[model samples]
Target: MPAALRITLTTQEHQTLKELEVAECVPRRTKQRATALRLNAKGGKVKAIADYLGWAQSTVRQTIHRWNHHGLAGLWEAKGRGRKPSWTSQDWEALEQWLQEPRSISSRQLSQRWAKQRQVFVGAEQVRRILKKKWRWKRFRKKPPVPKNPELKAAKKRDLQTLKLWAQEDLITLLYLDESGCCSESPLYYGYSPIGQQKSISQRSRKGRRVNIMGVWEQDNRFEYTLKVGTYNANSYLRFMEWQAQKAMKRLFETGKPTVIIHSGRFNPSCQGS
Candidate 1:
């Protein structure tokens, strides 16, 4: 066999290798290289060091060669040493522009669009990786509703605040009234199940009659609600309001404050008599 490759380390180089060999933060391969260099400096042969470290003999030789040429820098990898990304900055810019559209796009659709636009086919997995890692984008279930007239919404909010201040001073009793309806057949969409099993629920009927609720809430945490089997028409709502008004009159006399009812939805002129 040819003479065993031997390298002599300077005092600084030896100390650096000693520290790197024991360092916890460095990569395993870097630590291994440091250890191999230290051993070689102590007159350990290539094959012997390779056997002790469980590395191929050629790998040890390459490490020694790199250390000889590049010194401490050879212990870690250099940048741009692996496969390059296929997408460029221009491609990402185009993707950003595409994302500005009013609708959502899935990774599969994005990949297809990219292939169509650039003639470079990329998989959905790759597109997802780019979106998550490069763009730092996430998918959401729903977007919040935006008002048609923002200025009008702001004006209404300011009016509500003014009413709230009046209510706080006992100048008025502010009551919020609303109506909602829900079907009994609405099924629960989510539940937990044992691993690898599906969750399910049994129901006698898949469809059921709608239950309508008309409720009023006072600023003082008071609540009154009336339930109906079907919908609440103008006549039924007027009757409910009359009942609430009669109940409010008793408290109005005791508190000596005028009651102001606030309804956010459409109001029928027929209910004005109540």
Candidate 2:
């Protein structure tokens, strides 16, 4: 009959294995192997060590053989035992710092930065996983800063809903007007030019004059007006609104429907708006 496996350890080897238990830097497999070796060195049977450590007998034997051959280095797992990590904990720490910085960065851009800084090629998906799983980072879209008036925004939404309901009831026609203004610094458009012919730079220059224009956005038709006011004021805006309301009422009167003019301060005679 084959004799039972007998493993023994020296004093230095025993101390090193004990230290591995408290060592946080050692890998999990290394710690487990160290514990197994420690148990075996104290006259513990191979089967007992394996059962105590919840490891296979073959694993315990392999660890013993490795320790007998390589000593301290044997405590570590062999190379290529598992998948290689493209990034280390230090890389993840740097990534977390970057994420904490108040700036917008996309996953693709972050991967590029990682590749450049770490001098290692990493895929966006892999980086994304590292950020999500390792760092628990969340994805969010950046939006332009608007009013913080959520209540006002909610009110506007309710008003829009009411308008939609009114439209369904034929209460009033919805003429969504999109007003705009162009100044000498703003490009309204290029003047009329022959087809396939480019106009001169002087003619296309927006510095020539300033103009304000508005278009009624409704149905398949639109009424656009161009006005030139050096500085738009309340009077110019009121005139524009009055003109639009006149046109709207004219159409409503033809249809025998009451005219309800819903106007707010939205006209700019001068370079303010169009």
Q: Residue pairs in steric clash, candidate 1?
A: none
Count clashes in each candidate, considering only residues at least 3 apart in sequence or on different chains.
Answer: 0, 3
Query: What are the per-residue Cα lDDT tens digits for candidate 1 across 1-274?
Result: 7568889988998898889887655767899999999899899999999999999999999999999898889889998776687778888778767765544467788889888997657898978656654343433223224324788878988999999999898798899988776876543333222233343333222245688788889866888899998767678987887898897898788988878888954433344444
**Global lDDT of each candidate:** 0.75, 0.65
Expressed as tens digits, the lDDT of each residue in 10-29 for candidate 2 is: 78867878999877556778
TM-score to native of every candidate shown: 0.45, 0.35
TM-score of 1: 0.45
**What does the lDDT read for residue 17 in candidate 2?**
84
> Which candidate number would show the highest lDDT if scored against the true structure?
1
Best by TM-score: 1
The CA lDDT at 258 in model 2 is 55
Error of 2 at 138 (Å): 20
Q: Pairing residues by index, what is the TM-score of model 2?
A: 0.35
